[model samples]
Target: MINAGIIGASGYTGGELMRLLLNHSEVNIVAATSRKLAGEAVTDTHRHLKGFLDLGFQNLTPEEIKSACDVVFVAVPHGTAMDIVPELLDDDVKVIDLSADYRLKTAAFEEAYAMEHRDPRDAVYGLVELHPEVAEQNFIANPGCYPTGATLAAAPLAKAGVISSVIFDSKSGITGAGINPSPVSHYPNMAENVQAYKLTTHRHVAEFVQELNRLDNSLTNISFTPHVVPSIRGILTTAHVFTKEKMDVDGVRKLYEDMYRDKPFVRVLDGSPSLGGVRGSNFCDIGFEVDERNNRIVVVSAIDNLVKGASGQAIQNMNMMCGFDETKGLWSAAAAP
Candidate 1:
């Protein structure tokens, strides 16, 4: 079994990684690291994983972690990961960064986050459905939560080279902000509100543009705006795709189906996608409809931000990098009501 280690094991994504890796047939989680929470039971921070994981959060250094683990998941925040990632990447280990550090081209990352990229190296962008090349790499940069859903919603159209312009309006749950509670997460501020922060300047736009541009570079018109709703998990993206020519409903459906037919985690459905159906699962449920009158197609996608958007996708990369079946531990149903 592959021994896995997760750095920054106190956050939402880290906890989610542990939760999913528990069932991995070829994995044994050996170390969970958190400098501040060292020696404490991992359950102290992740009460939901009370019985399944008994490992304590260790304060292991990069060398120690690399020695003990075959795969290392960097689950720290964006800026912080750049500092830790370089030390972890070497001959013996595979590192999957669940951060924005290596997801973009170094220049784009520096421009978006307004920080110098300490380690500017080539790492496969771990959007497995589109980039099947992760199976050949030692390091992967997991896609951002918003980009995962938003990009998946419009990817078929983009890849078909029929997209004239795409505008994405995404609503994500409170947990996307992370484990720390902030003003927006306050009960009174968030309970009945739909707060749209960073209307045009949200940093994740870089990732959305990066992935779509990769599919169709000449397709320049891409825009995104993000909102935070009262829910705790999942991201629902509604994409308004204006095409060069009118696409019929059957044709549009065929595009999505043909693109994702062999992809295990992307479900192309007849109707619109909803968060409830994909919560706590690695699936990205997508649906689209053509509007003949406007020469446009409306596409929607849903995914658990913690799952397909973060930790679960990280493990999916791990499976591919390790040459295991892609769905070794992740082929399961969502926790729907």
Candidate 2:
């Protein structure tokens, strides 16, 4: 069994890592760390994992985790992970960071996140579908939740080199905000409300551009806007792709199908993609249509923001980096109504 450890284990993502790792057949969770909850039963914070996990949260140092775990997941907040991840590397242990720290180049990261990067190192951007080369690396920077859904929605068109520009509009569950309660997360304010923030300046946009630009360098006209819905787990992204050439429905369908055929987690849906179809699963369900009159194709993609968007994807990276079957634990069906 691959011995794994989770650092910063008191939040939504950390709890999710434990919940999902319990389902992984070949994994043995060794340590789960949390400064505030040190020595507390993990179940206190992650009640869903009560019966399955009996470990207590630790305030272990990096050397302690690296010595005990074969693989480590750094799930701390953006600025915080930069400090922890560097210490976890340089050993036999493989590391996957679920924060924004190592996802971008130093300059871009500093610009987008507005923090100086202390550890400037290279990490494979772990979008397993697009960058399968992560299998050869010891360190991976898991893509951000918003970027995971948004980029996958438009990647096929961008890779086909058929689109001149695209705009992504995404709605995520409140959990995307994290485990903490904000004024926006208040029940009175959040219920029956659709909140849109970071209109033209969300940091995840840089990630969207960074990943797509890898496919087609000249494809630079990308825009993104995010909204928070009243839902609990999924992100639904609608991508308006303006094509340079006229695209038909059949052709657009073929593009998405061909691109995702070998990617185990991405489903090219015959009907519309909905949050329900991909909730609580690592699958990315995509559907699209062509607007011949506007030289545009609208593609929609859905994923559980906490699963395919965060923890499950981090496990997917671990699976690849360890040479395990990509779908060994994640091939299950979504929890749909």
Candidate 3:
């Protein structure tokens, strides 16, 4: 069994990692660190995992965590992962980062995030379906919630040379903000509110555009907008595309189905998919509509931000790194409302 350790265990992504790893037969969660919750029982900080994990949230240095586990998951914020990852890389440990630090290969974007590139020129991108080989071999950079949804929606169209350009309008639940409570995430304020916060300047834009372009050079341009909705979990991404030629909706669905047939985590919805269907699961549910008159197509993708978007993907990376079944501990069905 591979021993795993998670840094920043008090946050949403970190806690989700704990929940998923606890059920993995090949994994033994060795340590989880949080300075504020140091020495506290894991169950005390995250009651959802009551009786599942007995380990305490110890406050340990990066090196101390490296020594405790064969693999480490950096579940901290964007800038913070850069600081911790470089230190942990020195030890013989694999890292699956849940941040934007290593997702963009360009140095310019690193400066935009106020982080200096300290690791090797290469850290694998963890979009499991597209890059399964990378997922199996090395340390990974998990894709952002919005990018994951947007890319999967358009990748099939892009590969077929059917779309001229794409526009993405995505909505995410409050948990996407993090475990820490904020005014924006407050129930009273967020209820009945649908606000677009990061318009053109969102950091996730660079990743979405870059990765899509990387997948197909024919996808010349993309416009993305992200918003926060009132729900507690899930991300719904709608991709609007202008097709180069007329294509039947069934034909398009077949393309997506074929592309992801071998992929276990992605679900191609027969009709529109709501966040509720994918809640608490690692599935990226996709559905679409075709407007032949306007030469446009609209596709919707849904996922639980904490699961498919973050920690669940992290464990998926670990499964690949350790040569275990990709669905080892992630086969739990979605929780119904």
RMSD of each: 0.8, 0.8, 1.6
lDDT of 3 by residue, 157-220 (tens): 8878777888999999999988778888988889999989878778888877777777777786
Q: For model 3, which pairs clash?
A: none
Per-model TM-score versus the true fold: 0.99, 0.99, 0.95
- Tens digits of lDDT, candidate 2, 34-93: 999998999988998978999999999999999999999999988998898878887599
- Candidate 2 at 113: error in angstroms? 0.7
Which segments of model 3 are wrong by more than 4 Å?
111-115, 118-120
Global Cα lDDT for candidate 1: 0.92
- Kindly list the per-residue Cα lDDT of model 1 for residues 1-337, writing each as its tens digit: 8899999999999999988999998899999999999999999889999989889999999889999999999998888988888888887899999989889899999999999999888788999999999999999999999999988889888899999999999999999989998999888999989999899899999988889998899888888889999999999999999999978988988888899999999999989989999999999999888889999898999999999999999999999999999998999999988
Worst 10 residues of 3 by lDDT: 111-120
Q: Find the 10 residues in a row with the least total lDDT in model 2.
A: 82-91
Distance from true location, Cα of 227 in model 3, Å: 1.4
True-vs-predicted CA distance for residue 307, candidate 1, Å: 0.1
- Candidate 2 local distance difference test against the native: 0.92
